[model samples]
Target chain A: MSIPITESITVIDTTLRDGLQIEDRVVPTALKVEIARALVDAGFRHLEIGSFVNPKKVPQMADTAELYRELGSLEDEGVTLYSLVFNAKGAQRAVDAGALQVKLVISASEGHSRSNSDSSIAQAGDRLLAAIQVLKANNVAFEVGTAVSFICPIDGPTPPQNLVSILEPLVAEGAAGVGVADTIGNANPRMVRTGTKAVQQAFPDMPITVHLHDTYNFGIANVVTTLEMGITRFDATLGGLGGCPFAPGAAGNIGSDDLIHLLHREGYSTGIDTEKLAGIRPTLTRAIGHPLSSKLSTIPAVPEPAPIGRASR
Target chain B: MSIPITESITVIDTTLRDGLQIEDRVVPTALKVEIARALVDAGFRHLEIGSFVNPKKVPQMADTAELYRELGSLEDEGVTLYSLVFNAKGAQRAVDAGALQVKLVISASEGHSRSNSDSSIAQAGDRLLAAIQVLKANNVAFEVGTAVSFICPIDGPTPPQNLVSILEPLVAEGAAGVGVADTIGNANPRMVRTGTKAVQQAFPDMPITVHLHDTYNFGIANVVTTLEMGITRFDATLGGLGGCPFAPGAAGNIGSDDLIHLLHREGYSTGIDTEKLAGIRPTLTRAIGHPLSSKLSTIPAVPEPAPIGRASR
Candidate 1:
């Protein structure tokens, strides 16, 4: 008998943007484009290619425009390219660069908002509205991401009502979608499911994407819960790269290969090639001069056939 | 207004027993005693102190009797010490060594049972019955552990009916309590909840302990889900130590310090000194010859205040 209620998941890789943010060395615009192409080739349909933030703040994203130009030229069919933006100015810059979508991040925790964005929820919502207006004017799809939606490292627990309150204005302002980020990776599966269900109930039609970090090692579990909650789109990094330079205890994003393997194993359709994604770990390892954090990077000694039986089998 | 139902969780440190099973080197009996003492000192009420198995099969557990003798002399008033065994002889050995309780592990997965114990589920159950009879005759408390209860790495997903069948006989054979072990770390939180509820329903009064491995990085999430199901007791290793020496993908138990921190943060009373437990990582690191897999080992820049805020504030 077949198991009922299988899920279809979409993996959105953000290695070039968020992944490179944690790297000490600058990744050239060409290298970013190359990684983007590699992710696309690996069957990642949604790619948060880069960010349109100030070059001074994020020197690695200094070549965001150049990277976007290169990606636009590739005209990679079957891929939706996206860029992260902090404010209206960044949103405008992303639109000017012909970016298809832009993501604006706000913090759900007040302490995180003050420390990371220097704005309260109300002020952050204003900036988000302004950014959404700019994206709307340019006819670009936009997503508002609420960071520390699960738990904040600076502040203690994020009350669910606080998160729902913060999301209400963004949904009312006509945000194309919402991204819930466990910024400091403190979310457990129960918390993820609770928050996701609450958000889904509040905004029935709004598309929700979960951005998770592996700091506390709940990234994969949270992703699983999100999948069960009918959230298909997720944010992952190649080789589990990226952490916020500003956020203490911020570690790698959930590894693309690891996430894809999990999704595939759970009988979900994620379209990504696990072997190809595992192949790129060497390049990232060489570039970073250290091993990556993905468990799938090193092949286990006794390779059991994929669970659910391989499609070929 | 009260948000939800939360309960106190009991943490059972199993590092010296199950954790040592996966160690590259055989941990000295003295080291096991020291680790057990540390766990007890850190306010762990129950500890799986050692395993009474054949030296040829599991060299690391060969010192089980010696370690048990050492812990027996220790002045731990609150700690309920236990040892693991496979058959009646092992239970006799533990009872002779002054163990308060003994655990017999029965593998639910046929492939694991054959590989791990050279027996089938029925044979293992028969062995467990003999062991329980021996323990009961000696008036020593005992619990039955069902390994690979959720899923097995060797065999694919274990059907719940199969698990129920394996457990039913044990419950009838005078098992004081029962535990479910995610032997190869393949269980997600949903699986944990489902499996736990089923077993709970089958044996309502049987105290259930959940042993999780962080192989797929869902260990903590699984623990969280089990806790939500009102299952209190859990097994954790110091620094995420121990894996199945024979199981291919099984690596690292859920770290004790990490789990304690997570529970403490979620308002669950685990009674563990997080700071003292964090301090124990160094000694474990020295013994293991490298840093362990725990994320909480690296001291957070924002120092965690003493567990003084809850009751006092």
Candidate 2:
């Protein structure tokens, strides 16, 4: 029996944040703002522009404050710009930059937490408490996202309960939403469904986004699985750029252009234009100084939607 | 609510026929046999060794007869060797070469038939009538597979009724099983599900297999969808090699190594040893004179089975 899919989904393009975090080339701030502008023009209402992390540790994201200063006016145009904040310092940085929305990220696994944040999961949660307080004090909206929420490279699989337990604090503290991530791109569809279901069961009313990577080519499939589960939010990157420096064998996030193509072809309305996103590939490729890894970027043309067959009819 | 998956699936390795068909280099006959033997050793009971096409048109398959002769003894080991035959002459070649099981292929769409077989679908059917007769006369087991059953490069999407109409004659003639293929690799899961559902309704008793390419990275996802429909048979190529030369933008078939990994991870027993398959990648890479296209071929490690989460527990 064919299951009915959810009617609509919200996609958050994370090209400027997660996508450029580990690049060898440091993209100019103007280029980052330009890509963000083009993404907004192409119908992306939610975007993760950058992270408020130490500039010396991650030079590519050093211009996050400047980017906010340049494009902060787009908030009036119904765009929601999100930046990653791990500690109170990062939260203060977001407030100083006039960020309206911030994502508080903590690793769900101990190994990833240690390497990614230099602390254990509990310690990372403790660190986030300060950021959560700052966001509350400044009246800035925030969502809590747990990285490596499905499979951790250093640790094996993050248990679904572990994801639930890790988000309990943030959910209790009035989180605007919750997101689960397959940080290393090693998760399968079953894992995604299992983990996201746990989070959904725990926070029934909170919006849940599933962050996926294309390392194993299961990104879109996981999206399909999660969509079937009625989870509506997804985070993707342009041209499938970016991998975690700390997560071994991690690949790029699922490409936004490719993801939207799959969504539209499946009869879901994304309100996003595939041709316009595809048109941005050369610019993305030029900025990255390498060809994109997305199927749409490498292929000659985006396949036209075929006629629906008898069974669907 | 999570649905229970089918207990297992049958994976037919088609590396020799579909994997090496479009490569720039002509792999040696010995290497071809070696790969076939390795596939069987890796627990593949069904293998498509080669096609009985003209030497000038497809030089890579010129050694089909020789390969069958070399590996024919494996039948005693319970391994079935399949070769593609399009006409009466190819059927005779299969019999002469000692092929106990053969696959009779016809393109479901008009454009593919004209370019691939130099005939219309009707003419190709008329041509296959002789091959089917020959197979029946010889008492050789045969299965009919429709190429481009989902989407055709030239004709666009082949409708479900078109697939059913093309396979009607063969199904009526006592074909052992039927297979629907995404020849150009541009098919999404909805197309696969829609097309396969129509075929299933038309011939409920005929066993069905799905042949997919990873051009758009939907291969495994389509596999997941088809499996949910209780269709257990699949065709894959080792190292994800091969494409349809007549179909523009067609990529390699779903990688056998990757397919087995996904199946096992999703709790479906394919009886395939992924480690053994991974070990054979180097030899395949050397034979093709290029790196393989499968994700597992390039990835450093096969992700280990992680602890099952709360829902399953």
Clashes of each: 0, 0
Tell me how candidate 1 scores on lDDT: 0.76
- lDDT by residue (tens digit), candidate 1, B4-53: 43567888888888777767777777767777778777788788877888
Candidate RMSDs in Å, in order, are 3.5, 3.0
What fraction of native interface contacts does model 1 preserve?
0.17
Candidate 1 residue pairs that clash: none
Candidate 2 stretches greater than 4 Å from native: A1-6, A306-313, B1-6, B302-313
TM-score of 2: 0.95
Query: Quick one: best TM-score, which candidate?
Result: 2
Q: Could you tell me the lDDT of residue B137 within candidate 1?
A: 88
Residue-wise lDDT of candidate 2 within A149-215, one digit each (tens)? 8888877777789988989988799899999999888888888888899999999999998899988
The DockQ-derived docking category for candidate 1 is acceptable
Q: How good is the docking of model 2, by CAPRI class? A: acceptable
